[model samples]
Target: MKARLMWIAGSLIVIALLGYGGLSYALRQNPHAVLDTVDRIAGPSGSVEQVAEASTGPHRQQRLLVYRSDDAAEALPVLVFFHGGSWAHGDPQHYGFVARSFAEEGFVVVLGGYRLGDEGRYPAMLEDTAAVVGWVHANIAKYGGDPERIFLGGHSAGAYNVAQVALERHWLEEEGVPESALRGVIGLAGPYDFYPYDSASTKAAFGSAGAGAESQPVNHARAGAPPMLLVHGEADTLVKPRNSRALAKALNEAGGRADTLFLPEGDHNAPLLSLANPWRRDPLVHDRILAFMREAAKVSVPVQPQTP
Candidate 1:
C-alpha cells in the first residue's frame, strides 16, 4: 500500500510541473509576442527606429520602421498605423509586416504603441493617439514622409481607437493638430460601437457603455470628418460586421466619404495578413487601401518628394 501511495504522489508532482509549464508559456504569449513574431517573419530588411513613448505615462514606447522604396525620397504619403488586440493586447510590431509591405509600395509607415488595459483608458488612448500624430507631423520628414498626407488607421481595437480619436477632435485639437491634418481613416475589423462593459476589462477601459453605449462612432458621425475606409470580415465572431456597417451608414449620412468592404467568408485574421501576401489571391486589402489613400491624398500618380 505504501508503494502504491508513492507512485500516486509522484504522478501528481509530474502533473503539477506540466501545469506550471503550460501557464508560463501562455503568459509569454502576450501582445509583445505577436510583435516579435512579425519581426521574425519580416526580417531585418527595413530600418527600424524607436520614436516615442506614451506621452501620458511610462507604460509604453512607440516605434517606427521605414522600408524605403526606390522612390522613397520624394514627399511620399504616410500611413500612421495602430495594431489591434482587444485594446489590451496588440503592439505595433505585431503588424510590422503590414507596415513594411506598405513602405515597400512607395509610402512611409509609422507604427506606434499605446498604453493598454487599466494603465490607460478612454481619453488616455485618445491622448496617446494625438501625441503620435503630432510626433508624425513634426518628425516624419526626417524619415522621408509627408506630414500633409497623413492617413490614420488601425486594426480591431486599434481601429476603434483611431475612429474615436479622429471623430472626437478635442484630443487632436488640444495637441495643436488641426482636424485637416489627416487625409483619411482606415479601420479593419474594429468595434466602433457595441461596447459591452459587462466584462471587467471593457468596464475598466471604456466605462459602462450601458445606456450611453450609443455614443460610439455610430452616434458621433458629423460633417468635416475625414473619409473612412472600413474593412470587415463578415464572419468575425468577436466583433460583429454590423459595427462597420453602422459607422459607414452614419458617415455617409453626415456627408463624409465612408465605404465598407465586406470580405466574403473571410474571418478577422486573414484580411490584414493577406495584405502582406498578395499571392494569397485574396482580394488585395492593401490595394484597396492604396487606392483609398491615393484618392484621399489626391495623388493621381506616384509622387516621391525630395529626401531631406
Candidate 2:
C-alpha cells in the first residue's frame, strides 16, 4: 500500500513537470491562449464577477469584469487594466490571470474590454477608455475599492488607450468625468509616437479615422497630469523603446511626474509577462508598478462637493 502511494505521488510530480515544460514552450508563440487556459484549469485566484453588459456595435469594452478576494475589510486601491490587440482584437475574459494576480495582491482589479476593429475606429477606443474610468470612479466602492485611489494601466494598444484617455482632457470631459479621478497611469510597451500609421494594425484602426492628426499621447503632455510609469523593453522592435522615452521626456519637460523603466534586453511582451504567474521573468517591472500605485494612492485628487 505504501509503495502504491509513493508511485501515485511520483506520477503527479512528473505530470506537473511535463505541464510546465509544455506551457513554457507554448507561451513564446501563443501567450494569450496559454494564459486563458491556465485560468481555466486552476480557476481564478479570486472571485470574479461581470459588472456590465457588452455594448452593441464596435464597443467591445462596454462590458467589464471585476476581481477581488473575499477577506477584504476596508476599501482597497483600484486597478483597471486593459488588454492590447492593436485596438482590433483581444478580450478581457481571456486575461483573467492578470485581474486575479493583482486582486490577490489586495487590489480590486478591473479588466475591461474595449471596442476593436475598423468599425470601432480611433475616437471610439478612447471613448471607451473614458467610460471605463468613469464607471470605476463612480461605482468601485461597492466592490470594496476606493474610487479615489484609481490606477489605470494597460499593455500594447491598450496602453495607448489609457495614456491618451488620461493625458487628453477632452475624452474625459466628453464623458462628464473629471480627470482628477485618475491617481496614476501605467503603460507597458505602448506606442505613444507612431505617427505615420505605417503598421497594419495602426492603419486599420486609425488610417481613415484620422491619419495625419496629432492623436499621439506624446503630443498631449502637460503639467498637473497624473503620475505616469512608462515601462518598456530596450530590445523591443515592435513599438520601439524610443516611444516610451520620448513621451517620458515630454512629460518631464512639461513638469509632470513621469518615470520610466527600460529593461536592457527586454522585448515587447516581456513587461506584461512579468505580471503573470509561474512565468514572471522580470519581477522588477511588477514591483515598480506596485510602488508607484501605493505612492500615488496617498494623494487624493481635490474635487469640490457637488451642489444640490
Candidate 3:
C-alpha cells in the first residue's frame, strides 16, 4: 500500500510538472533520460531499431535510430532528424519524443547523431550528415522505408547540418546520394547566414572553418535545390530569424522552393519544443511541415497508423 501510494504521488508529480510546462526545463537538465521516460509513459508509439554505424568509413561513423508506427505501410516515407545542442552536445537517444510524435503520425522517423564538440568540427559534421543520408538512401528500403521519399530535418545546429546537405550538391554527390532523392528539408531555428561567429557554440564548432562563405548554407542556395521549409522565431535572440529569411529569400530568387515561417511569440527553443507531445501547442508548424512533405513527395494522403 505504501509503495502504491508512492507510485501515485510520483506519477502525479510528473503529471503536474508536464502539465505546467516543466518539460522544457527537464529536457534542458537531462534530455536523454527525460525523453526516454516520456516515451515510455506516453505508451507504445512504435517499433524502434538502432544501427551502430551508417557505414564503415570514418565519415560514416554516425549512429541512427529508426522508428516506425506499429501499423506502418510497407514503404513508408522517411524523416531523418538531428538534434540541436549548439553542435557540441546532442545524442540520438535523446529525441525519442520527436521520433514517437512523427512515427505515431504514420511516418518512418530516423533520429541521427553525429560527432560533437571539438571532434565534430565543420566538415566532419557535414560529412556525417551526408553519410547518414547516403546510408539511408541505400539501406532504408530494408527497414520498410521508401529510399526515394526521404526528408531531412533538424533543430538549430542540426538544422544547419540538414540545410547544408540539401543545398550543397557535393556532399550528397560524394556519398552517391543524388540530391533529387530528398523529397524535402525542414530546418527549425537554424543559422544559415551567420558568418562572423560570436557565440561560443558557433565558435567552438566553426572556428576552424573560418568566416568564409564556403561553410554557410545561404551561399549554396541555388536553382534545382530540393524543396525546403525553414521555420524560425522572431523572438529568437540565439540564432535570429534573419538566417531563415535570408536563406529562403536566396533560394526563391534562385528558382528553388524554400518556405519561411517566423513566429512572433516564439523563442529559440519554441520550435523544437513544439515537436514534443506535451508542449505541442500550435498545429501550424506540424501542419505546414506535413503539407510540404506530402506535396513535395506527391503523396495521395496521410497513411493511417495500424495498431501496434
Candidate 4:
C-alpha cells in the first residue's frame, strides 16, 4: 500500500511539471506566430482593404488595414485597434481575426501597424498611434466609418498606448486632433500602472523616459478624458488585474467615466484570443466590446451573433 501511494504521488508530480512546462513554452513562443496561427484557423469574417501607405513612421511608412462588413452601406461606428507585443512585435496582419470579428458585429475596424521596441520607443509608438488615429479620422469616411463615433482599444502593451494617447492629450494635440474626437477607449489586460522598469522589455520600451510616472496611464487619469472600458481576466498572470483596478479607481475619483469588466475566468490573452472561432466561449469578448461602443456612441444597432 505504501509503495502504491508513492507511485501515485510521483505520477501526479510529473504530470504537474509537464503541464507547467507546456504552458511556459506556449507563453514563450513568438507572439506574431501565435496570432498568425489563430488567424489562419479562425479565418477572416469581413472584407479587408489595405492602405499600404496610411502613415509615415521614423523608420518606415506604416500601413492600416480596414475591416468592413460585406453588407455595410451607411456610416458605421469605427474601432481602431492596436496590437500588443511587449512594445516590440505584432502587426495588424496578425490581428485580422480580431478586426473581422468586430467588423462582423457592425463596426468598421481599423488595425494600424506601429514601430516596435527596437524600431522605436515610448513617444514613437505614441506618435504612430496618433498618426494612425488622425489617418482614420481623415480617411475612414471613405470606408463607411463615422468619424464622430471613433473608438480606440488594444490589448496589453497596445492597451497602454491607447490609454496614453487618449488620456495624455499631448500626443493627439500634436496630431491636431481633439480629445473629443474619440467616443471612447477600451483596454484589455493592459499594464497601465507598471512602472520602475522591472522587466527588460519594459525598460527597453520606457526606461529612457525620466520620471517613469509620466509613462504610466494611472498617473495621467483625470476628468474630461473619454469614457473608458477597462477589462481584465481574474487569472491573468502576465499583467496584473490591479493595473485595471487602479486606473479605474483613479478615473472614478477624478469624476471620469471609466467602467471595468472583470472576467472571473479570463487570463491575460483570453480577452484577445477568445475572438477566434471554435475557441470562442460564452460571454464573448466581442459582444462586450460592441455593447460598450453602442452605449458610448448612442447608436442602437442590433448585435449580430458571429458565425463560427
Q: Can you give the TM-score per candidate against the true fold?
A: 0.77, 0.84, 0.85, 0.82
lDDT of 4 by residue, 201-266 (tens): 788888865436888999998888888888899999989899999998888788677887888888
Model 2 pairs in collision: 61-113, 61-114
lDDT tens digits by residue: candidate 3, 265-289: 8999778766754445356677777
* CA lDDT, candidate 4, residue 251: 84
Worst 10 residues of 3 by lDDT: 299-308
| Clashing pairs for predicted structure model 3, backbone only | none
Winner by TM-score: 3
Report the lDDT tens digits of candidate 1 across residue range 221-269.
8877888889988898777789888888887777666876788787886
Model 4: clashing residue pairs?
88-117
**What's the C-alpha lDDT at position 155 in model 4?**
90
State the RMSD for candidate 1. Answer: 11.5
Over 161-269, each residue of candidate 2 has an lDDT whose tens digit, in order, gives 9999889888877766676667988999999998888988888888878655468999999988887899999899998989988888888888786788888888998
- Residue pairs clashing, model 1: 73-305, 74-304, 74-305, 75-304, 75-305
Which ranges of candidate 4 are over 4 A from the true structure?
Answer: 1-28, 31-53, 209-211, 299-308
Better of 1 and 4 by lDDT: 4
Per model, state how many residue pairs clash: 5, 2, 0, 1
